[model samples]
Target: MWRNTELVRGLTLSLALLLAACAGAPQRSADPQQAESPRPAATQAAPPELPKSSSESPGAEPALAETPMHADGLEPSADTAANGSSPPMDFWAGLRSELQFTRCADEDTQSRHWTKRYAGYPQRFQQTIEQIAPLMQYVAAELRAADLPVDFVFLPIVESTYFPHRSRGERPAGIWQLMPQTARGYGAPMKPQYDGRLDYAQATHAAITLLTHLRVQFNDDWKLVNMAFNAGEYRVKNALKGSKGSRLPEPRGLSPITIEHYAKLRSLGCLIDQPERFNLQLPIIDDTRALASVELPEAWPIEFLAHLLVIDPQELKKLNPGLFGTHTPGFPGYRLMVPARAKDDLIAGLAPLPTAVSARWQRVALADPEQQRTLVLQSGLEWDLFTSINRQGGERVWLPTGTGVPKPVALSEPAGETYRVRQGDTLWHIAKRYRLRVQQLVDWNGLGKRALIKPGQWLRLRAPE
Candidate 1:
């Protein structure tokens, strides 16, 4: 019994030693490279990082108390609050922080028209927010990406109330509310069928660029910049010459125009601060997956293209507000904002559409080419289109002379033509004149996008493929 006990004790002792050795053993590295290059303990043991809080991150929102309660008491879904994880750059919250145009102070009814009325501002705000949901995010993104204040985003609301392609029978148009000259300066094409000023994506970029320039020029004083934007920099600077350098002490000495602009912006800012406090059930405005911008070589009918892309036609129209009508003009490398969900489908469908199915061409008939006649173009219908098609003209035809049309013709063009570049001409003007696409001009001339064609420059006008 003593011998058996001794043997058992020895076996137990050996097992204990083996277990302790196993517990203390250094593990081998799974990666051979890691084994050769020993990493520091901190590096190997570091945990995956969690997302930072608002206070810790750039492009983040201020605390909830500093701003109005976002999402209007509801939890966030696809709805965007100014600077959250939502789509379009957390528009409201972001703009709220960037606001220097006004203080959310009490009634200055004498100077501000918005304050005199009922709570129409919130209602209008809600309406516009809802109206511009899918598109708003894109514009907001541009502002944020440019590092411009969210306050400038609201200027569009003041200007056009978030409606793209809105014209006030005045000079300015589009969501950013840029004037024709400003729009042209910022690369907004003034084509008859399609105005780039109405283009949400293009106009947003241009607007941000213009605003950034104004901000830089005015030494980052947004109020003065906005005032300048509304009532021209020249006028704003002229008004400031009477001031204490870029800032007015009070409403006492400012021009009426500057004051009104300041007052209107401030009024809107005040109302926007506490929309929920006023009982407005504003939606969360984020829609990150709303629209995707696709580059196009030529024009395509919005409805038809949407159908081809397997998306909602109206949704495409809303995304592409600057198309002005049924089709986007065939400009060279035109950016088409389509439904984000349909991007893959659109790209897949764009593999050289058939001649019968090509959106570029439309049927037009010659009504006895002997009489003086003309074609008042619809949207996307280029005047230079005649050179691309088989024209059987035996008589002189004057444009804008009431060219009566009620005939069916083949879509195929028998030949092409050319034109000399004249002063005060553009690809849009040339394309409009020749009824050919800007893309066609680019392809034929082998020019870059929006390349400068000097006076007396030879350009193809529907000259054969």
Candidate 2:
């Protein structure tokens, strides 16, 4: 007790000295009598103040506010809640909502390969979608119109990355990645002059048509249809033949490639369906910038038409990718794609455009051959434009836009009852033959606005006037 008392006394003295040192001694006057006067207790120093928080002042640095965690935390959302309608109906959401296979299967029981890691696939796909927004949105709208699963819209990601000009192994081309045979089967021409496989509108029609047919063949099994699309119907059938098919209700066959293909699709579908899982955000896209297809029979210069319509020629080419040159090769159903906004103005001012583009001009040599060919040229060149133009290889050929093109032409019309359609016959040719307007010919024939006249379809030469 005596030692404790001694320790407490020592601590007391030390603390008092420390306080005095911290408080600091006040200024000692030059005269000691002034310092002898007692300073008030309030004048003794207090503790230093702390810096102000950001919340208290505008100039202070701020800290992130923490979200308060409850005893019960937030939960993942259910697909269908009280209303049981659906998730959001946007493009990605629509695709996700249609997925029949949601539960991840055990590796031992399932054939799906989760091998392809999520390494930049989502980012690449989002970039590609942005690059081809108009075309993709158009495809999605068509799919919705057909009352089919919109999941097929993502097929182009697997096929060609939405690039219209992509080709593989010297044969397949376009956004759909259709082979020459498949393209022909769907009535898209793949000739040297004009490969219709690259045409966005036409290819979308063909893809949907092909999908419809595949759906029938595979009994509406989209997985099998997708496999058929990727590996061809023959291989898919063979795969189904060997194994009891599981992707569909009916027993289907499976192959390694087909399994891998579907696995890739499923993987791609997941990334698109839930991009947040991969830390990616997709751009909102629409095909609302409307494109109108204008059927013109003559070989018109793309540049001239673009200038007249006030559209960029490069952009116009994107809309009409089938035409493989500066000037359209006058196929029978040559549709020129123009901006829907400018369609009315172009139609109003089309007087500057030539009446005919194909087999409509004949070569005329002048004294000044280069300067005077356009002065006195002739229309009604032979129906066999390929041979006629090739024969005039050495002559200066005047174009519909009054420019000179130094190249040959393409295929001829067939002889049959009321003009059998040839490989490259445009409606203008048949109309001109019967001395009827192209619209009259189309009206009599019941052709769609953008429909192409195929090689063997007989066209009506004359109607009751």
Candidate 3:
């Protein structure tokens, strides 16, 4: 009985020890697949990084604020800084980064359609791009500063093909293709003397203003905004109101023209987004701001301004197409778009120059029997200034046998006296006659390379002292 009792005690003690050992040991899971295998502390996984929202992300297309135009007319707004990403390398890349609508699968298909069409005529496409490179740079900078979608730069692309002075008979004008009433409503200078629709700077501002207003009216739906931009806003509003059963208006609700315009916007945007997809490389346009607006105290002849700035007169005309005829109107605060490099020089020239007095012009009848004869001035100057002042550069200018020609009646005197150029006089001959270098004569009068001396035109014998 004593031995059995001791054996039972030992057995009980061993059983208790075994149970404790089992309790302290890590238990194996019933299903090995379902086991919770903990990794080392250092090897633990981290939470995934979240993508940024559109508003917070750099290069995201945000709602544009309705800001006033720059205090200096025609100045490009500074670029918005990129946060947490590398900066864009060029203008097209910068523009592509901000594209939103053209990124999706549905939009990609639509945009790619246009890309294929444009790619068909690669040379024409390339020429058009080269032609509008500077304008595109300026417009892109302006759109970016306005906080507008960089895709808005393509508006001009689809509008007038970036023809700033596109003259269509009584239709919407300028690069933005603004209607006359719409242009005037938006405060674009729409006078008979100066058509602001032809002025890129004014038209861009007006178009941006109109677009902003439309965006608000359309509940920020760019598709509808673009539709309204093409067709009248009333048309879009009417379509939306009539579509009682549908959440959005059907494509059939809009006219084919408006629909096409919207498609064009999308397609052009898509082309810009994925040029490579269309088997074409994107053109490399410099991202630099290439244009500046200069407010002139007085209207200066674009020719004179071009000569002073040493730029092509045709380029100056192209930039300031709003100016009537060959000169800017004689009004205060007349603005001129000049190359950025020439802006400071123009401002400097304006500061030191004395206000020019209006010259008294008189009409003198020509006694030439030939109907197409070039009129000579009595002072031995050619009638070049007269024809220029009168804006007579057509192939055939018809004047009666005794038609009147305009000439300046008075001279300011002094400045080493003016010499009257004879019918056969040349710059070389005149320079030798005055004992002056040909360059001096050319410099004093702002003479061009031709140094064309017209019979009866006056020339300064000496430099202004």
Candidate 4:
């Protein structure tokens, strides 16, 4: 049985990786603090009371390490308490009351929705939860420190299902589901060298910043803040105008919005109205006393740390999904959150990031004359990997074997060329098809919005030069 389970797990990971490879990769945001000088690794010792793995079921609703609930808080009214006993109303009421709850500890009594929604595929959900629960603890601590509602930690679960590489409509990316504009607004640089949205630490800071801003804008209303996160501030503002005193939004605008937006906001409001539906509770996670930090050397890979520490790479990856790629990108250094007592040993065990620069036989080319640099193709390297690394430095560098870069294919003098936009086509796609970048596409077509391309539009591929 154990061997079978291990086989299943391996197959699952392999499938996930295969799917990822087939899908077009999304853009990532960069860490803001990465450009600063690297910081030395933390020298503190690990905490003595690190929670034992065997104590709690892996991926079970995260066991809160510390209670943040204060007794002075207002008690729920009889009406609220009465509602809490109802199946639909109970779970959410518990959340609103800031009490802790989970799926009925009895596996049999667990609601079908809860089982299907959260626990049906125990292996997959458990794996995701185990990886994400630690980070959730970190997020919860940060929010609680600010006196904000702790349920904000659930946003990532809904957004990415704890998958750091998940992407949605357009190029909105990362666990927090940030679009490029919003990511940039939250201080994420959308450049090749860095993408802050994928940097877990930086993105968490940005998520908190955005959440705080939304909370303030909504007058500390958690429900409205959640709505804002789902549908954008403008849509939420419109919804607020429509939902006067009722707990639910009228069924009117539901059609106009995307199902994801509609479903998420409705689910959020439902949780507000009747928390028991989701078996949610505000958890106690204030165990900062037992927390310690592990700092990484610049560009250190978590996989290497995992190998050095004799821990599973997946374990380290789960703990630090924000690292992105196989290694830390563009960041000068990063801090890893761990149980407080384990800090010293972790730091002591870490090996310095390798910097052996070998001039292996590789093809080279001049990509940009302005930078006075050329792209090199290292032998035996994957073409996509090579291109991705070079693109990180900006300007087209190298193409895969059998995909030679077309040398500035110039358009003939002043002829109107009609181009039909296909499905999944964007200005960026059109630019690439014409061996140009987004800027060139916009300039050629006189388009004001870089993201506004649609299927079937006839575009003039070339302008009078």
TM-score to true structure, per model = 0.50, 0.50, 0.54, 0.41
Q: Residue-wise lDDT of candidate 4 within 1-465, one digit each (tens)? A: 000000001111110000010112233223321111111100111112221221222123321111111011011233533443334332234344542222233123223333334322333322233334445556666677766766666566545433344233335555565655666666544443235565455566667777887888787766556556644655455555644565344323521222232233233333333433444432222233233345553444444445344456654544443433445443333455444545665565433212322112112355465333223333344544454344434443422222221222122222225455544345543442243456766777787863477756777765645
TM-score winner, 2 or 4: 2
The model with the greatest TM-score is 3
- 12: Cα error in model 2, Å: 77
Q: After superposition, how far is residue 118 of candidate 1 from its true place, in Å?
A: 5.4
- At residue 267, candidate 2 shows an lDDT of 56
Model 3 residue 328 CA deviation in Å: 1.8
Q: Which run of 10 residues does model 4 get worst, by summed lDDT?
A: 1-10
Query: What's the lDDT for residue 420 in model 2?
Result: 55
Greater-TM-score candidate between 2 and 3: 3
- In candidate 3, position 224 carries an lDDT of 75
How far is 184's C-alpha from truth in model 3 (Å)? 1.5
- In the order shown, the candidates' Cα RMSDs to the true structure are 30.4, 34.5, 32.9, 20.9
Q: What lDDT does model 1 reach?
A: 0.47
- Judge candidate 3 at residue 8 and give its lDDT: 7
Ranking by lDDT: 3, 1, 2, 4
Model 3, 376-445: lDDT tens per residue? 3333333553354334344433221221222221222252367665444456544432335677888999
lDDT tens digits, residue span 1-465, model 2: 000000000000000100000111122223311121111110011121222221221111111111110011011113212222233346556556664433132122222233124334444334344444445566777677776677677666445444443333334556675555566656566655567677766666667778887788887877778767755665455555533544434324443433444554565555555656666566553324545566665666666566557667756665676765557655555556566677786665554434645333334444565444434344433334323333334454434333445243232212112555554345653442233467876787888877788867877655534
